[model samples]
Target chain A: MKPQSLLVPALVAAIALLVMTDPAMAYLDPGSGSYFFQLLLGAVLGCSFALKIYWRNLVSFGRRLFSKSRANRPSEQQDGPE
Target chain B: MTGINEVKGSFRDPAGRMFRRDGVLYRGIAPQGLDDYSMLMSSGLYEELCAAGKLIPHEEAASPQAPTDELRFIRPREIPFISYPYEWCFEQMRAAALLTLDVQQAALARGMCLKDASAYNVQFVGPRCVFIDTLSFARRQANVPWAAYGQFCRHFLAPLALMSMRDARLAALLRTHLDGVPLDLAAKLLPKRSRLKMGLLSHLHMHAYFVKKFSSGGAAASSKNTRTLPRNALEALVQSLRSAVLSLKSDESSGEWTDYYDNTSYDAAAMDQKIRIVADYLSSKAPAVVWDIGANTGRFSQVACEAGAYTVAFDIDHQAVQRNYLDALRSGRGNLLPLVCDATNPSPPLGWALAERDSLTARGPADAVLALALVHHLAIANNIPLESICDFFGDICRSALIIEFVPKDDPQVVRMLSMRADIFDSYTPERFESVFSRRFAIERSQRVGDGPRSIYLMTKR
Candidate 1:
């Protein structure tokens, strides 16, 4: 699935998790809002990044399978012509 | 501390404070900053950044009289003229933002992260932006989201988005918001279409939402949860921000004065003669620094730069400054800096106690000033008296002034007069020379070709 499709659900889940979590224990006040936002966004981006990697791997796997089938057919045609 | 004067703006970071002694700049690192300072040096980050020209190079100096609390002292190379973000055009600000990110990434590569991402930490030394605050880095902690994420968003991303999507003039907002434009305000001002941009959505709109949501609850609502961010995720987040910044492009349509040189009243021969005359004056004086006020697209400012003087080309029009900056970058003119400044109301001393940033005049006493074809606008258009103008120039330039006097009968002046009543009875060449004579002595005077306009090279009295 596309990253955009996963965004709303990820956002909702993060917000829910944020609501349930205890008050933050930050040493440096990067600003309460900014710190929280970074956490929430970091999770969403992480998921999307993982999905992108998986998607790339799946595409490469499919491409290899198709190329192997084509190569077998070319050899069979050569054997018939000989 | 006896002879050293602490730089006021440097006190914000307790890690170290920049001070000047005997007219040389130095950074005093307190005992608290020792660990980070040592790490910054030993981790090879310092050498890498210095070699890349991303950071200002400094040398450790022995100062026996250094403050008792200071553990070490290092002197940084001085920038010719210190310019604030408010004076920067859209492209210049964008360049600074990208440079900040680049430095942060480089720091993260070596188990370090920027402690703070303030725009003030970045400064332009010519056309290139360099991260000036050597003490801004800290050892990176595992599973901690970049601590300066919010600040980076506020200082760089917000203003850039507003400028690119809304209006270029919105950059002046930095002058008021010295810390950087508030994220909430930036979110409000941005066009609705910006919400469609994923980077803008997460970094700006949603970021502002969280800030407002948590602001009222204070520290109680602050992030108490220890959410772990994988190193890959953190890198991805920074990459996202970089993409956001890269996506922003300034409106480069020719501004009112961007094409000024092409449409000027002077013929080609007259323009050439004026260039030669200005070049002659600059070469003869050999001033170390030159300020070209009313430098429209920096035509004559180039002459000053080519003469081997560090030149600051200031113009009121944002487009003009933007064009001039791009040209400087393309030509690799390390001696030229183009900034937006309204001569009538130049940048004033700003920030805490009004000492954090230097005003235009406070930064100057430049070796020479080029006021070519500028007096009439100040005199006739702005209604500033010639004496006051002369006084202003005298206060800013130390040695020489190459100024042009446009007679009332000149086509440009005539056009300006046509729109408004010609009440400038004292705006004559004779009045100009007499009034200016109080501050400067006329060393040479030559008319541009046969035009009614005359250029004067004056020595300050």
Candidate 2:
């Protein structure tokens, strides 16, 4: 199942569990929806972490292009309007 | 004239003449203050103002201490607690800022104007802000443009604006800038967007600009003769500043440590039972002063105060402290005072080589300490062992400790461990009692309602 498709059911089940439980004596290990949110968030994070490697190479290429153009120019405050 | 020790600093006004005789503070009125002093007292305004806590209470000299030509020298009752402006929380500082303006406005209405708008002149009477400088008022001069206007902006406006516009932590800047933070520096620190506000632009940015521009030139010095605002405009300026100050509210509804109250295991019944137990204990112990540690919302501090003991309610939460302070003011509660303090890292001996103001530990060893609902957070959250917590309490106060123990099975403890690992395998009630019993003999322990938490009234061994 797609991670996004399970989000609604996971949230509904979490809320249902929390409402039914009363924590007077001792606190629950985690509130009902907590695990669902955590798992979903972990999946999203894992995908993003993989994407960062590709973005880093693109960023370095842009930096190299910009630096080479900057080094070709004179370092001076050119005349600008007040 | 019999002389007494003089207090230093900008208080050198009234002619470097503050004297402490037999532990009572007295400000000697210079010859200039003679007529105003007579008008202030004989007019019955001093009595009226002091009784209302609007002005510092003073009584005319019983002994004839005035010089032959000098008017009467009066002695005002000293404030029970002398807290400097720097030590005040954000709400306290804002209330003081507004009070100084109120005093100026009232004095102006009485045909007098405050000579200085120093934040040091105001202090908390319960939660109500009262002016402490009975002699700060002077007969108003026509067309003088309120000489105290610049001082007011520097003392109150600058610091408050910095707190609101920049960050609330900047209120501590008052500690460093005793004479009030420099307007130029405050303006510089504020984000550039704040300059767009008319009040900030005019009072801070423009005021600082003019101060620098004038101080550097001789023509501006000569121009002082030509510059004068009408009396009406001066009064309007005071009102404007008062509104501006009163409008600046704390950015956060709950200060950094507010969730603590919600995180606790206490239901309404458990809280009530704890208060009832503390009250009953106090009636028997009959201590003169009680220090309520981690006193959130001050519900139990009121119990101590109502029991005829002066209570100092100290809490780490700024919002809790602010709420407690405002409630005390609204209720006119004089016997209790709320201060912001992180018990773990309380205020140390500071100021003028560290003796001017007493540190938290230096100030305490109160008759008793109400450490209710505080042990678990210190033990589990802060990693302070239960036994060390008991020893720390033993060192601070002499007699009784009203503490609460929330077991690990309790929901609050489970919640604290919800997002974290359960490394505290030894956090059990039996173990807690074994460690704490080494120092304090547990006098009585009652389970709060049907909850797993129990309140203990322990006596130091």
Candidate 3:
């Protein structure tokens, strides 16, 4: 996938981290570290969702091409006299 | 995800739209909605209701700039948390229903009325019921039918009647019937004797009858002329409904899991020792939150809370949770919150797409967990393996386990084993330690007096 698609999810993860890791708290435990990693994993998973949308558009484009061919191949069969 | 953006519940009157952006929640009040909103606010009703804690307090939009296409935003006071009706127990729902009527009476005095009566509009702030939907108010039609009557019956009356007569467990029926349970179905499930009571006969039993009878025959099609009731009569009807609803009482007894503390095999010496062990463990680990699983009336949660830890006193028994919650409220205990939870099947993630709300597990991995008298049920009754149970706990918390291991000869385990085949071949104290030692280090363990049960304070490795 392109880097462009990954940008939104990466930003979301960074924002989530920033909100959670504010200066007021004590030292981070293993659990918080695990959760931070989970955020990044969530971003990677989010990229697949974006890819699926693009894939669907590509499939629809191919289907349109096939349908156009079929329409052209069946030309003038229903032409009517005046 | 769903209904988060779309306007739902009582807010339907104002073009059915309310939303929260960033942290600010807002409602759209159209020009048509303004008259009712103005009357509700200006007629001293808003102040009266807000003071009584009947309505959620809201301030005017911070800026004089009206909401428009270019910059459509109006900030209203935000609710801290939004709880669902299904999560509410019987008393909570009852309180909300009463509060709704109280608000209605206040609105009526101001020459306005509530356009909706959806239970979803109510949320609990501490122990009090506060109305969350500010846009539900509308100008009272002087001689017209109660606009929210049918909704009130479906949302509050039906569920309350069911809980009052059948079983308190029937309160969970709200999860299935999101729009509120059908009144007709409620009437049928209710005992035949319930129909004998005047309130039940009129509100639920006869109310269902008329609704079905009229709808089936399309009686409204026969006449274009509208039937209207006077404003005073409408107020009277509201009062009567309130009185009727309040009269319904739960015939269901306390939850079956009572007497857990009494039935425990611990003597006074052992109990004191166990409490001391837990208190010491708390001092060392110093967790902010503690979940006392199987915490019957919060005997142990109190110990943790006193140690400066916020305790969630969790128990399967409804009565235990009710008592715990009431005690916390009465004592003004800010650090303790009691919740009814079944360990085998805990509170699932509810609401739209299941992501909008957190489940018991999603909400937790508590700072620590107190599993006293809880392991046996998971082992004997539920047929869960000890290793699996240990792993589940390990996944949920960082450190500390205040747990008890009841031997096979223990009365509770014996009873659980009596009805079933003796399939638990490994249900021994030695085996319990060995299995748990795989994931948790046994920090401390002491057999409680002459009793076969042993309380262990284990730290997750």
Candidate 4:
């Protein structure tokens, strides 16, 4: 497998290890279901958040590329009759 | 700590206990809470929250002697009246839920997190909801999910969603389930279409499934199995929960009394006169705290509020209470609180030893009570005797009672009697005055405009 593909799994494993090792002191019982659900939701939301940021970046990059190409074109050619 | 009487409901948290010494409420923080207390004070979160009115303000009180078990004593400003979650209208409950979330977010920003999200921790001072439990905060630990996540879902999200989507009456479930409505029960009770919403599905439906799956035990026994939630992930989770809460809207369409003002027998002139009468009585009494029983949309309660009295407008109808609450919020009336309460069967004492939450009557005898256009419903519709109604008013009113006695000939009472037998021969104006006079001195009585109804100003004996 490619190193880039291994990165995600490695990060997940590291996070899981950290989660297991961290000691939590809570007076109220954080139910097993609630704890696990939060973890699952957190991961999903984190990924989506990252994806949203990247998506916006990608869109802006595409816009910049398209605008650069348009700018390269002759002004007279872009506007036929103004 | 020797003379102080610990608050019964405050025993759950080991870090501190709320106690009263010489009628002043103080929190005695244990040695276990020293670190967190210092962090809270040093981090400036306490000041920020108090300034924003999100938290109840407190001051360091002089301790006679620093006991070994006690770290510090803080005297918090007393809440005039304590009300429970079940008594709160839809908007009030929603406001409380949002306030809890906002406080949680603020705490997170200061490297702290709420250790518990019990609805009991949130108290309403008029229209604004404030967090009262100072010991609920703990220093945030990295790679751990919120300890109060399940509680938030149960205490706030589940009930709020149920009230918004299913039925407004479902909010009363909070009375029975002191911890909060069970997620599984909430999931089942919610409409099937609610599962279609991603927020509800993930937070409630799926969360319930996970809880049930792990209920048999051993699933959460080993810390090695716990999955990490990074700080950003935790923030994302809180944001998602906030979105979920925000997405659920309060249903203002339900309840019988939402449109009652428009359909009442009283004309505009009569209502105006009635308002003036109530205001006159309130001003004469000069009550600091007033409870407007059956305050539909809080029209007369507003008069009491305008007369410089902190008023609690209560109604059995959820929509009416919600409408009243919204009006209070819009008008920025900090002295007016609208609550949902059935006069017949009000909120009873609940929780551990049945002493944790005070019964409706236990919190009162308010300085005054405004029972306007409500006696007929209790006496005629509910078949409650005039004597009993008078006795009840005596029990709930400390000094003054400004109650309207709608006679049998009144249009509203006549309409009410249309649906039931007019067996209440004793439900007469003379009988009302006679019975109430047993417990109170009738100071003044005036007829409402040209109507047969009369508003009485009585002082409790």
Candidate 5:
């Protein structure tokens, strides 16, 4: 939503546009470097999408972790009979 | 069309071969495909995907055709109608692309991978696209890139880009290039500005460059270095591709018939009356599958679907089909599928030996066929003879036919004739029925209100 957030994508796409401008007649993309790049891109994108898909879980996990830590601190500060 | 008929498209994967006996579908699993399949079955991925309707379910047959060399024989649920990618509109193609990814992602979670992601492997379960090839799965290798990445780009990505970046009608290119629109051609045809998009830049344009630049004499030195891509990376790739495809949604073009129902000559009451008649005919003799040809915006097709029939709504107009598909998505109706098709030149069988995909006619013998308000375009505009039209219908519909004959004086038909001299003299309703009588016995006929269109319910002779 921020202008700054839009800047990175616009920049990356502009560069990609520059790189992809070549008029290459050879479209046989069977395991080419660009294909690898796409795989890498996919992996990154997939992870982010996955993160978004499970954002609720991620938030709950964070809350549970924080609550457990707070509970542990009180127990640690208050020594038991031992 | 029955008994041990081998499905031509099923042979490519050594994992299995598909065949039909009577009306049921049987899959013969190869030795190599057994372990992965068993793992998938045991891991509960197959059952889960099927439960979600993302995958087609199959069961092991009691009898195995070749028990020695094969793992087991299985029977898959037969698809109601088999439609090709070329026949799909942008929304359909995009949904299919996403479905393939969803299946792959689910497969990855269970330590399995799709050996191939060919669009041919995906088919319409109704409005939704699903993976049908039971044998496309394999155990995932550590740090291995998606082997079907390039295939995905071709079959799904390229055609989509062409449609999005250039024109929607370019989807027909899938007919000539069965393997998919050549990536190089897609790159060339794509507008210069498309390179600005990261997905298109990396996947298509740059891919074409590398393919041409490196694939020199099949012994390109750079081939060896294209090694093991981590699973994380593959997942990211799928995600990126999904967004890329999703963004291309706005590029669809609207056709004249996109808003057809809005401008139709029929008043609301007349339209309602015609719908009642069609629905009555469908309910009396309930059909499992219904094909509504020239279903502009699927208004009446919805009626067939409401009658609990699996309906395929075909229209030559892309925008109308897109709108129809959008409506299905919005309403969440799985019984209706909207496809872009020209009835005059129906989809012909293409691919390996012209057998991989079935022609529109081959996929049918539908339990019922609806030809509402479609005759005028065929007879007048397309110059198809009335008898030939009847013959085409007879070839496709096995049981029932609900067709409407628009009179010559109807505004739509008159508009069609206004362009040229009225050469279709035998296109009268009497002549139409007499010609159709050769193949069908008319069961009922009614003049749809005061309109010039007459609807007929006929049974095959």
Candidate 6:
């Protein structure tokens, strides 16, 4: 049998183990502490992802601010896509 | 303050609803949504996305129709054509996915997140997928798993993976399931080998597992009621999803209709003459908007555009539409839009109340329509009768139509007949003329390439 094909049982066991070892001693439901932790993790991860995405934009913005050649830019007669 | 017209498709996002007044589209920000809309407006993310041509830009409407009720009313730039995901080729769907991910990443950077990821919120303006829903953004919260992650997967990823792995026509599943194809369905339909692929395995297979386990009531919250996904993990998840989406390369162009142009009997000179003739007909009655049906690779769409008509190139083959879109990008032409559509079962009026999305004909009464080298396929292959075909064409175009008829002995038609028994006894040039002439006044007729086949330009009677 392929090792990859064994993940179904492995995953089921992992879930079973997590349920058995629950430290909270109560059914926490959807709003449980661990779920909150995951959400928090997601938010922080989102912040970092955003930062990584805008790094190039930040550098370009900095370059434009520092460059003398960018001093005189024409104002838009209309607002639209450049 | 009297007129109150809903934009029809904007009811989902409670933050703001798209409305219309005096024929102009306006977004009315609700009280609950005002704070987030205000945050987005001040954040400069909107300006940046617009500057990059990634987001559709809007302005405060000069005068509000409902001034007292609205917090901040603005008018959005009108999208020339609104096309749904089902109508998109594989490449277009892929492009929409990339754009959504980029928007999400950008939104996160600006301390905002996409509240939802619906392919319906996107509209194509000249080869670029621009997000149109102004209220899709909300202030980002700490430790929240991407709320729209599941939606993003369904709307963009599921259909894409299904299209790439299972069958290209499976993309049409978006049309039937207005909320996007369900994960369980996609997971089941995907091949056994797909389980080995990491991205597909985790996002699709594992995702389906969780959905079934938690949802099915058999295992009632197996582990914790909820699970924690850390920042790094969430990023990894998004990245993984992106990789899964990007990995699917469309292998569409080699379909049945793809090689139709190659097998054509028309020589270069004949092709040029046909284009000139079509262009001349288009110029005589310069249509405001033109629809080129069976526009394989959009060769005739370019002719319409060159002759100064905004063109919507509709082709059944995804690869052909993809190529047409790429050509539009390379040529920097704003007038042409390529869409995948099987003329017989063209995209129907779909979504809530059947009006959320416009049907193929709902977007039309095109000022002019070009139905070139398409009749034989509809008549012979698909078995649509000629009179019904004429009536369908009649329903879509108002001013003019340029259609071609390939004769029974023509190689393409003969090839179509070679497989099936010839039931079409009335498939004569004379019969064709008489049937169409009932609905359309023949403006002009010319035989293309010394063949029995002919092209006719008609005015709807």
TM-scores for the candidates: 0.93, 0.69, 0.68, 0.94, 0.84, 0.82
| Model 6 error, position B85 (Å) | 0.5
Name every residue pair that clashes in candidate 1.
A23-B224, A24-B223, A24-B224, A25-B224
Per-chain TM-score of candidate 3, chain B: 0.78
- Model 2 chain A: lowest-lDDT 10 consecutive positions: A23-32
Candidate 6 per-residue lDDT, tens place, A26-46, comes to 111222222333343344444
What are the runs in model 4 whose C-alpha is more than 4 Å off?
A1-19, A74-82, B1-3, B64-68, B223-225
**Can you give the lDDT of residue B389 in candidate 3?**
90
Evaluate model 6 with DockQ and give the value: 0.06
Weakest ten-residue segment in model 6 chain B by summed lDDT: B222-231
Q: DockQ of candidates 1 onward, in order?
A: 0.32, 0.01, 0.00, 0.43, 0.12, 0.06
Residue-level lDDT tens digits of model 6 in B1-461 = 35767777777666778877767788888787888888888999989899998888988765475345567888889988788999898888989988988888888778887877889878898677899888888876543445566677678888888888878888889888987888789999999988878777766776666666556444333434333343344555667678888778786537766676787889888888898889888899999889999999988999898888889999988878888898898899888999999998888887789879889998889999999999998998888999999999999999899999898999878878888899999999999999999899998999887777788999999
Q: For chain B alone, what TM-score does every candidate structure achieve against the true structure?
A: 0.97, 0.79, 0.78, 0.97, 0.95, 0.93
Runs in model 3 deviating more than 4 A are A1-82, B1-43, B57-84, B139-144, B221-225, B252-254, B280-290, B304-312, B325-337, B350-358, B362-367, B387-402, B407-411, B425-461
**Model 1 DockQ class:** acceptable
Q: List the candidates ranked by TM-score, beginning with the highest.
A: 4, 1, 5, 6, 2, 3
TM-score of chain B of 4: 0.97
**How close to the true structure is residue B7 of candidate 4, measured as C-alpha lDDT?**
85
Please give, for residues B227-268, the per-residue lDDT of candidate 4 as tens digits. Answer: 567666677788888889889888857579888989888899
Alpha-carbon RMSD to native, per candidate: 3.9, 23.6, 26.5, 3.7, 7.9, 12.6
Best by lDDT: 1
lDDT of 5 by residue, B1-461 (tens): 32467888777677778877675788877787789789889988998899999888887895544334566889888777788999898888988899998899999888888878788888986788888878777887655557677788889999999988888899999999887787789999999999999888888887777667655534433333344455555666777778788878646556879888888889988988999999999998899999999999899999999999999999999888988998998899989999999999999887778888889999888899999989888988888888899899999999999999999989888887886898888889899999999999999988887878989999999
Separately for all candidates shown, the number of backbone clashes (residues 3 or more apart, or on different chains) is 4, 2, 0, 0, 7, 9
Q: Which parts of model 6 have CA positions greater than 4 angstroms off?
A: A1-82, B1-4, B216-233, B419-421
Docking class of 6: incorrect
Supply candidate 6's per-residue lDDT for B354: 86
lDDT of each: 0.86, 0.68, 0.68, 0.85, 0.80, 0.77
Task: Give the CA lDDT, 0 to 100, for residue B262 in model 5.
Answer: 85
